[model samples]
Target: MRLAIANLHASLGGARVLRDLTLTLEGNHFIGLIGPNGVGKTTLIRAIAGLIPFEGAITLDAAPIASIPPRTRARQIAYLAQGAESHWPLSVTRLVALGRLPHLEPFRKPQAEDEAAIARAMQLADVETMRTRDVLTLSGGERARVLLARALAVEAPLLLVDEPVAALDPYHQIGVMEGLVAYARAGRMVIAVLHDLSLAARYCDRLVMLNDGNVFADGAPADVLTPANLREVYRVNAEVTGEGRAMTVRPTGQI
Candidate 1:
């Protein structure tokens, strides 16, 4: 699926968060969204997922997403939001099964296919061991993985994740990134909002940098993460190193 955002603008509680933002994500591309805190990265993800209203157009494979209902959109685009809450004591397996609701008949219970999808999602997210555990009892990282499993259970072609690795350790972070990469390799599109520049540069096929409600940079990591861009957009002194496929970022000081 090809996802495109055109002239997109969004505001929340009378505060504008996005301004004429536009981008295109071809299927099988792992695109990274990066910026300083409160730069509307999350808002962009939410708008794309149809979780919030916005101005302009979002299309999946040239089909206008705005014309689709929220439920239909949920089936097409699965979202894993940052710091998403799960207060209820739903079991991990059961929680993951919720992803199938969009495909189920009203009031119908999950079938064999749903179970298989849940299992597959758990395996993909490396959360199989926590299947029967109470979600409230899991650690932050564990819970994040479980939520990611839930999103995977949806089996959408477009995945939107907001800071999915924020609570994870280095090992789990890599694991999750690998899972997303694998998904994209399987002809899906993954858009992730990331704070860690090094990880974004390493994992993403392309990068989008937002500043003050607009796109500051959009291109390959090397082009968008230049020292000048880092200083001007992020207000930080940083060094970008590596040649070809081994690039890395190091922040020297706050500006």
Candidate 2:
């Protein structure tokens, strides 16, 4: 499966946020979107998910995503918005099971397959222990994980997650990234907006660096995370160490 975005433009509150942006996203890999704040990473993700209106075309499998019905679109793409919240005080399992809505029949009970998918998603997100707990009662990190479990439960062809690890501890951060990487390796597409450069470099198959609402660089982590690009775009000094699968990026200081 493929996702194609062309000449996309978006605005918020009469302020232009995304400019003429175009990119083609392919499946079976973990893609990381990274940039400084207010660069339109969230806008771009929302546009692709058809959650926000844009002035350009976005297509899935050569068909315009805008024309697809909401339920069908939900089946093709699973989105986890940044700072996502649940106000209903639902149990973790019930909330995560909501991912199956795209596949469920009206007024129908969950089938065995739905239960299995929910279980697998919770296991991948390390939220199975909290299955019966109320989502509102959980800590920020725990809630984040459960929300991720909800997204993963969809098992869609494409996963669009915005800053999935932002509130997690070091251990859970690693855990979430590892789960996403494994998910992509299992032949699905995972595009995530990540602020942590080191984690992005360590886990992403490709990195798209955005600046001024446009793609500044898109390539392997080592290629795009150069010290020169860092200074120019991020206004920081950084060092890239290690090679191949073992890589670490350390930000030295401001430029």
Q: lDDT score, residue 206, model 2?
A: 94
Cα lDDT, model 1, residue 165: 94
Worst 10 residues of 2 by lDDT: 242-251
lDDT for each candidate structure: 0.90, 0.93
Worst 10 residues of 1 by lDDT: 242-251
Off by over 4 Å in 2: none
Pairs of colliding residues, candidate 2: none
TM-score of each: 0.94, 0.98
* Model 1: residues with Cα > 4 Å off, grouped in runs: 243-245
